[model samples]
Target: MDTELGYSIIPLAILGGAIRVSTPFLFVSLGEALTERSGRINLGLEGTLVFGAMSGYAVAYLTNSPWLGVGAAMICGALFGLIHGVICSLPRVNDIAVGIAMMILGMGLAFYFGKPYVQPVAPDLPAIGFGWWSDIPQVRAALEVNVLFLIGAVLAVVLWWMLRSTRIGLILRVVGDSTDAARAMGLRPAVVRTCATAVGGAFAGVGGAYLSLYYPGSWNEGISSGQGLMAVALVIFARWNPLACFGAALLFGGAGALGPVLQSVGISEGYYLFFAAPYVLTLGVLIATSSPTRAMTGAPGELSITK
Candidate 1:
């Protein structure tokens, strides 16, 4: 390879890593963003994510179609969210405690169903190529990107617009800001939260599907490693903005890829440290964004966790 070509490869590799690794974070973060915007925190998303991955992989393995798996995952995720929402809507149930319980339940269900799928070879999702114009071998190689990334980008823009300029978005914001205000305006807080949770769960399910059907085919216990939890932190760090979640997810993705990228470059020292980079970065951002002194300025007023 030419010197300049070799030099340019690093950036390309980083970009590839960002796209590949960020898919899960993007999905989960967006889901969390939606849930938080509706004035609830679904810590159970971790369970939803893992369970969705297992369900998606198993369905794809049995049916030989990745889309079916994705659909199934979404359904399962929505069901999980519905359960969480219904339980949380109860008079005195602590959302956090309920979230933890749901997480355990979701993971258990996933593991039980996932046992038979540990070794199955499943169909993978198709990727969209944007490298048609690139004649250079490295350029072509570097430009191979997933179609979901584009879809996610579009979703972010749509969500931003919806939140800023739509009636439904206004209702969600009002409900999040003040349940009394929502009630005074004839809006049902429980109904809105239920819908939001269900929608967020669907997104999280898609993220899990992406994990099993695209980034890594087949099912296994180790398919995920706290991507869902980190995504919850990411939503807080992004201040519940969909667009900011996208950027933050990309950054987390890059952090996640550091270990493997370092190994590729022949530096394997402190491998575990590389894996911890995303978590550490997330914690740092959370600390900076959350402070009693400043009172988490952009946070929705009705959010229990932030308050």
Candidate 2:
């Protein structure tokens, strides 16, 4: 009976943790999807995530409002994206190089600015309770969902719809699929790409806000845990589709949650090994999806020229 009970709660706990942990992945991947769809890639989102975490935490601490912190982080991230865009727009400039430089700069700025907030406590973002239906205490705690998760879910649907039907989405697709075509249509590829990158960065900022303002719920030196970088791969895995990003994020989140679920169920043996499961899963996904004979399906044509 005890073993049966453990099995039941374990999956529930993992499901809850996946929703919580994947929030950042969902936001960042969606942002990357937008950027990549515009025929540009920003490898420096890791820096953006770090900076956002710092800025969001600081603002929340000072203003007593987590949402304001999210706003500040978004602004900061947009600025970073803007800088990256400007550099990449110059003739003969390498987007990847510009992205790397931007990441370094963002991390440096974040470290300088985030130092003071490390010790201070910030207001936590509010969470939603979906576990009221469950009688078990562990299940209830595990089922506590954050508001951002719901928002992210809605965003996925909205983005999917807009991309398929909106004019702006058409323009982005054209720019990504063919530079000459965009030029023929009198569309400025540079400007469009720049705007896309900025918006993508803003989304990454929200992801960072979720990191510091919710899970772990504090400012620290290592807040992102490479979710920004993971998001890039996630965008590729999702074939640049916004809706696919949400699913990929949940998959990654489930991998991340595996260790804790086992530990919670009194299965501590080799739990440390399970902790690396997320990274392993990422690598495995990349390997399985890799193919030389076929081009990446749904990849933006301009994406190949970034190198």
Candidate 3:
């Protein structure tokens, strides 16, 4: 009976964790996908993510409204993206280098401003309990989905459609594929990329808000745990596709939840090792997708990393 119980909980626990944990990744990857598809990259999303978490938590604590916090975080993230876009637009400027600098600046600002709210209890975002019909407690817990995750899932589909069927999407794709062609058609690549980057930043910020306003709901310095950085590699692995980003985010979330899920099922012997699964998975993804002689399968041609 005990063995059977363990077997049942493992899958349930993993499913729950995947749904809860993948929300941030889904948002970040979607944001990155949009930016990259517009012929630009914003590595500073790490900082944006962190700052968003901080600001989100702080605002939630102060305003007593979790949704307001999310809004604040999105605004902040957009500003960061805008700054990155504007700076990288200047002649001879390297977006990657500027991104790194922006990352440092964002982290610094978040740390400095977030100190006061570290201990405050903020109102958490509500979850939609899908397991309401279940008699088992674990089943209900496992099925408690955050609204943001559902929104992200829907968003992936919407973005997938937009990118293929919309004129705006066509212009963005054209800009990403060739700046010269964009210029020939009276389109401004720099302006388009800047806007795309800002929108992407807003997405990352919402991911951060998810971290603080929902799961692990709180403000802290180490709250992000490099999820922001991992997002960059995830975009590559997804081939810059928004729908693929959703699937990849779930895969990553499942890997991340393995250690905790195992412990819940009384298999804690190699606890630390299990925790390393996500990073290992990330490394494997990068190695498998990288090439010395050619660009990624579906990468934007104007992306610097490919060139």
Candidate 4:
């Protein structure tokens, strides 16, 4: 009976886990894609994500509103991005180094301020039950999707469209491709890059909010587990496309859920090894897509990593 149950539920478990786990990756990758499109890289998004998680949970606990917490997280994330953008805009400043510094700073600040709120109960984000017609508990659980995940999906489509069709998108593409050309065209690369970084930070903050207000649904330092950093690799794997980011995020999420899904069926052997699947997948993606002599296909011309 147990073995039979495992066979029946494994697919369902993976499906549910994929949707539930992909939200943060979706938001962070989208944000990073936008920033990269403008020829700037914000490694500091990890910091923004962690800080946003802490701030969102703290605000939710105090105000008793999860949405408010999300708002606060976005605001805070924007500020973190703004700081990174401004500093990197300075002469001889390395955006990558600044990003790393911001990550450490954000983590330190979150740890210091988040300590008091660690034990508090915060309001969690709501989910829309898509499995209401199902009689099976596992099916229902698998189908109940979070509102933020839906938002991220829609945002992915909208973002992809905007990048391809809007004036702002064109400008970002121009700036990303050549600073000299953007300048000749009367565009300020510094300003554009800075704003892009801030916007990316905002997206990452929302991702952080989802981490605390949904899924794991709690405030903790370890909640991120490097998902924030993994998003950078995810962007590369997606070839800097917002829509692709969504699909890639789901793939990563499914991989992440593989170990636990198998363990749910009493297949505990190599359970810990299963948890490493996402990282291995990340390695595989980087290896497969990366080449020493050529830029990745569809990569922005001005992207620092590509150069």
Candidate 5:
């Protein structure tokens, strides 16, 4: 029986699954990239992701509109970011400690508020049927790409362009590179970082909406599965570049799908080990990048150091 099911793992299946699973990762990493670009690091997005999932699921249940749910989730995520930004802006506060606290608060609130929506069916996000030209059912099924994924892809390109070309981007770059320089240029670093963090949160919310409103398509306590936390490491690997973040998201997504794909191909001898691929990959990346003597390459100066 398992062998018959395993026969279906192929390039088409892996590609489709990679796109589907990577959507959330892409969004979260992009959000964090933006935050870090503004000289701030927000580790609390894990809570925001879960909160957005819960909030999005609940709002969709109530309004019968998945988009509205997305909006609600964005709002929820923004609030968390705003809180983080505002608190961090105050003197003598540690951003990392605050992030940990915010994450705990967000998770607690999400679990409490999300309990009612778990059993209810929320509307699913619509998908574009790109598989129509394919003759094979498996190929067709694999090509049913979700609209949010396309949006995130486009967003990655746009973000990359904006960060490199726009005036606002220059201001952000200055702020991230040096608070004193921003002040010299009559720019307010706190304001820029706060806005950046809030916007970043909104993007993370959309990722959460993708979770509950599309893939998996349900509200549950375990819906997030550590994607948010993993995004922080992904941002590091991507060098805070939005385009790189997009590529890294796909890589992580592909890594995550390895287990399921192997099982589909009747390779059940080490089914459980395949599931460990993503985590193992993440650990390897962290280990490879670990250097105590110098700062991680490409890190924003203001974020990695107070001076």
Candidate 6:
């Protein structure tokens, strides 16, 4: 029961936990980053996330290929995004409310279809071995990262470049900043928003895929616990930057693993508080970053939530 023991193990525990837990957040945050950059918000990403998880697990279990399941989940997610975009485009419907409804629907559908798939095993994802460079056993073990983690890092750089240097990125940013300005430039705001939402949904779907194929590799009612919603908050905390999302996700992942790490060290007090770490951190970040005293900025202008 040495307090120093927990402190000494913090680095290894954080690294391992970050690897195991950040995949879902990475996917969801990236998706939201794209959607928000386009001047629209798909609050229903929560629904899309759970549905994608169920669909990915079920499909992977049936087909014996986790990759295929991930692809299928992306398709399903895009379809959901398309539906959300279309609905939100309507004159009077509130996007936030629609998102809530979609969440209920998505979860319900997941539970209903997932009923037949209780605890089904799916194929697992492959890991990357950067551990060859590490001589220390703990370092090597902690550095045994997933290929998706690399992909997420690459994606962040690519997205940041795209937003800064690409024409399409410029168009999306312009549209998000101002619908009138977009229209003035002969760009279609609705079309941009719709595409953004679809892409975001696809990312959420991949996030779901990660949950079933990599971290847990099975389908159950409790497979995901509010990851989708947390990703939304994460996007804001990341300041809508995909690269920052990667770092934020890793932070969240470490926070998530605290409970298990504590239990591993034979200290189980306040386990539930450790589980709440990610949410609490997220809320703190949001509060610190979002200041009512100053003009709440950085979000696209056409976005309803920001307005």
Q: Write candidate 4's Cα lDDT for 1-307 as tens digits.
A: 1234547787787788899999999999999999999988899889899999999999999999999999999999999999999998999898899999999999999999999998989999999999999777788889989999999999999999999999999999999999999999999999999999999999999999999999799999999989999998789889889999999999899898899878877888987789988889878877876787764777888877778
Residue 46 displacement in candidate 4 (angstroms): 1.0
Please estimate how well model 3 matches the true structure, expressed as its whole-model Cα lDDT: 0.91
Alpha carbon RMSD to native, model 3: 2.1
Please say which candidate is ahead in lDDT: 1 or 3: 3
> How accurate locally is residue 293 in candidate 6, as Cα lDDT from 0 to 100?
70
Poorest 10 consecutive residues by lDDT, candidate 6:
1-10
Alpha carbon lDDT of each predicted model: 0.84, 0.87, 0.91, 0.91, 0.88, 0.84
Write the residue-wise lDDT of candidate 5 on 1-307 in tens digits. Answer: 1223335556666687788899989999999999999999999999999999999999998999999999999999999999999999999888889888988888899999998898999889999989889666777777889999999999999999889999988898999998999999999999999999999888898899899999988989899988899987789888899999998898788887788777666777987888888778877877786788644776788985434
lDDT over C-alpha atoms for residue 103 of model 3: 88
Name the candidate, 1 or 5, with the larger lDDT value. 5
Sort by TM-score, best first. Answer: 4, 3, 2, 5, 1, 6
- Residue-level lDDT tens digits of model 6 in 1-307: 2235445576688888898789889988998899899987788888888889889888888999888898989999998888888887788888788888888888899889888777666788788777788566666667777776777778878988898899989998998899899999999888888888888899899888888778776777777888899888888788888888999999999998888877787878988988788778878877776667753566777778778
Better of 5 and 6 by TM-score: 5
Q: What is the lDDT of candidate 4?
A: 0.91
Q: Report the lDDT tens digits of candidate 1 across residue range 64-169.
A: 9899999999999999999999998999888889888988898889999899888778999888777789777656655666766777878888888898899989
User: Any idea what lDDT model 6 has?
Assistant: 0.84
State every prediction's TM-score relative to the real structure.
0.92, 0.94, 0.95, 0.95, 0.93, 0.91
lDDT of 3 by residue, 133-160 (tens): 9777778888999999999999999998
Q: Best TM-score goes to which candidate? A: 4
Per-prediction CA RMSD (Å) = 2.2, 2.1, 2.1, 1.9, 2.7, 2.8
